[model samples]
Target: MSDFQPAGDGSGLRVDLLAIADLIEPSSRVLDIGCGDGELLHFLSGSKDVDGRGVELSQAGVNACVSRGLSVVQGDADADLANYPEQAFDYVVLSQTLQATRNPRQVLLELVRIGRRAIVTFPNFGNWRIRWRLMAGGRMPMMGNPGEYWYETPNIHPCTIRDFVVLCRDLGLSIEHQRVLDGAGKAQTVRIGGSWANLFGGQGLFMLRRP
Candidate 1:
């Protein structure tokens, strides 16, 4: 394994967000969709020197971001991405929000349409623990990150790494870079068109762009 990871400042950002920050270039324009409290936006602005902006679904989140002096507005991804013109930013990021979206494919289309590169992350439904829970106990695994029961959770369409790969292919988005992380938020060895990443990865992060 390469053990290559995104740079971090020990700012208490989630491992995935730190990973995302590593992918972004300096002085670029960034739009973070579903940016809860603008942690990633704040980190990117300070660490990468990017002009960062955010779109949040909750007023609480927007208020938090604003308090932190980050440019964030209350908006929903399913409804607002279309308002932006093409390639308005250098990078557009959506972390842990794709599955909860009403139309994941449509949102993805808009991501690449509005930014030169789109960075995305999601929980992996095909992880071994999740599979074993379903197979052995006939129950869905409870995710700790969001900490909600399956019935109470808002993720309408949970998907795996393999599923996302297929969707990206269907959408004709090129996968410039991808990372599969274990439960501890460490990167795993990449294996494209293989089941290892799907079977073992607890979370998946991808960088995509239109051809």
Candidate 2:
């Protein structure tokens, strides 16, 4: 086991990333796409016995990761991935970033193509809170950390958990494991939590394998 450190924000790595790490084998190779500030990659490298690299579009994010002694490349996901050979990593991670891409499906396909397993996390658009907001407010719904001005929001392909699962089935991606997050960003417990996840969970984490 490696030493653990809190994420800069002190809440530690997002619960989704921690769950994904649990699924990964020790000393695995990981590539994190759209790795803002490389928090997840840094945590995995330091605390999970994984070799990690990050691809980030923001120069500031890239610089921050590099300064932390983490390997990172400054490039867009839509473009940078083309340079990596097929199956170059054990796991390719896309956390909280799939919705921000201009081409979510294409990027997801690329992730699976470039790695044996893919870990993906994203905000759930079909949460009951969001649904209620849309139904009563007549506007795009916002909640938790995603609340922001429409013009400034990074989510380009916001989708629901059901939408994501449907897409995976349509694309022939097999889900290996999954978890949902509550409003507090903690993993929702099973039992009743799954029901809430199906209706009101704020985010989702999935481990996918190509079929």
Candidate 3:
């Protein structure tokens, strides 16, 4: 980890975000979509020596990021990204926010178009806890960070690691690396994920590149 400490109260960065940053090459330009308060971008810029910028729709999120001297734009992921030419950045990141987008595939294509590589992370809807909750209790599983009332949930495209891999195959995106996080965001016990791990892993992160 870089010596640069996060600006705000130590909510600390999310483990998944840290994991993604760990894979990034030093001095890369990064664009973080749905950047929230720019915590990850700040860390990347200050600690990892990355040139980082963000796009966030929430006014409060943008303001908070700006207050910390971060560069962020107010924009929606669903909109066109024509302003950015092909491969304008070394990396484009969409962490734990892909499921909330109006169109996941389109947004992903744009990310790859605007950057040489993309990192995406999201909750695994196929986790065993979620499956058991639905099977045994007949209820949508409330698990980990995604635990929230059904009516108020932000996830619109709940899917598993396998699902994402399949989507990548179908969309012609090449996945360079993948990682699954346990409930604590630590590496899961299972290393080789397939059908079994896909149904049990809590969250997943992917590093992708255009074919």
Of candidate 1, the 10-residue stretch with the lowest lDDT total is 1-10
lDDT: worst 10-residue window of model 2: 1-10
Positional deviation of residue 20's Cα in model 3 after best superposition, in angstroms? 0.8
Off by over 4 Å in 2: 1-11, 143-147, 190-196
Candidate 3 lDDT, tens digit per residue, 74-157? 887888465778999999998878888888989889989999999998888888877888999987766434447666677777
Could you estimate the TM-score for every candidate?
Answer: 0.92, 0.88, 0.89
Task: Report the lDDT of model 2 for residue 168.
Answer: 90
- Residues forming the 10-long window of minimal summed lDDT in candidate 3: 1-10
Candidate scoring better on lDDT of 1 and 2: 1
Residue-pair clashes per candidate? 0, 0, 0
Prediction 3 global C-alpha lDDT: 0.81
2 or 3, which is superior by lDDT?
Answer: 3
Task: Report lDDT (CA) for all predictions.
Answer: 0.86, 0.79, 0.81
Sort the predicted structures by TM-score, highest score first. Answer: 1, 3, 2
- Which prediction has the highest TM-score against the true structure? 1
RMSD for each of the candidates: 3.6, 4.5, 4.3
Candidate 2 colliding pairs? none
